[model samples]
Target: MKSFGQIIKANSVGKVVDFDAGVDRLLPFDFTATNTELTAAMLDDTELFSDWINKQLANNNARYGVGGYNEHRTIYSRSAHFDTSEEPRRLHLGIDIWGPAGTPVYNFYDATVHSFANNDNFGDYGATIILKYEIAGYVFHALYGHLSLASLSGLAENKFIPAASQIGALGPKEENGGWPPHLHFQIIEDMHGLKGDYPGVCRFSEGDRYLANCPDPNVILQFDF
Candidate 1:
């Protein structure tokens, strides 16, 4: 049997977020501890963090900022949602495409709505959706997080969603878990009986385990840069 990455490479998938590298530029962002420019104060204030994001794009002449898979991000320190007394979940498990709010998000493959929910906690996913897919005898799932609340209005479990269909739009800071507007795209090999959400970040110690369950999203994204 082919692995999920192999299956993805064998098949063509659509853009989870509308982007054209040929015409539009994508700036890779760094949220790791080494990026001294992103101070603890700036991250704690959503407006400041958002301003910094926009500045990077403006200065670089890029349309969107993208990155954060397997990254040890320091930005999570701003919210208690990602931290526990025992461990702090700072290692990101998804690829984040940061852009303007209301940017359209599409399905990468023909899929069924496995689940949907508004994970409204501070630093949470906000509006989230999970799509189930079966390809070449392999079954897996894709998760789209930080979506607008309106995206959940007419969705239902088991609903057929065509490839490249517009399923949702990016939500604003107030609605998208108080972060800069971005789509959190993750590929999960197993749902583990979870619904509507899965851990998009893990503690540094558990990186190997979480990274296995959530493969690199770029396998499906196929972005050139």
Candidate 2:
């Protein structure tokens, strides 16, 4: 496996955020490790942070969403946001690459389309796509929520997304699943009862349960950025 930072690249060059122009606020490993509340097991025991950072990178062939809410919504999502409480959402499963509308997104790796649907709603993945794959002999699935209508048009079960294939594009705030325009990428070990969509938002009471089913997106996209 490769380190997350080594696999993914900055989606947009010179995109500024906070104080840096043309640069998004990248996330470092310590952001999750240093947090006392985060369970050690959830993040690979604080050493490697699960070898899947490439999942978050943006190749030139690919256009990563490039905004830390400065250009788009200016808000942020992170695992640290999830607490032990049963609040609606305790953590952010995927790294949102914020950029303008119509940016193309690529699959981090080869995958089989497990399930997809138009789960459009306020704060929901308007057009969601979930791809199943395996790593280290372990079966898993990666989901791309909040996709554009063009991305979701005419899909089927068990679709194939070749490694780095252009599968979808970033949606705008008007219909990108109710969010202010960002991608919600998540890694799941088990689908549970979820079929076309899964619970990205949880009640504070179910925080612990969701945390178990969904791990950190960094586990796949190890990029601290």
Stretches of candidate 2 exceeding 4 Å from the true structure:
1-91
What candidate 1 gets wrong by more than 4 Å, as runs, is none
RMSD of candidate 2 to true structure, Å: 12.2
Q: Model 2, poorest ten-residue lDDT window?
A: 67-76
Query: Residue-wise lDDT of candidate 1 within 1-225, one digit each (tens)?
Result: 677888888888888877777798888999998899999889889999999999999999998899999999999999999987588999999999999999999998999999999999999999999999998878889999999999998899999999989999999988889989999999898889999989999999999999999989898987766
Question: Worst lDDT window (10 residues) for model 1?
Answer: 13-22
lDDT of each: 0.91, 0.55
What tens-digit string does per-residue lDDT give for candidate 2 at 1-225?
A: 543223223221111111232453443322332444334443433122212222333332223433121111102232333233544243444556544466677776667889888876544677888888754445677778778878877677887767766788877656675444456777677997578787665544555676566666654454444
In candidate 1 the C-alpha lDDT for residue 140 amounts to: 87
Clash totals in order: 0, 28
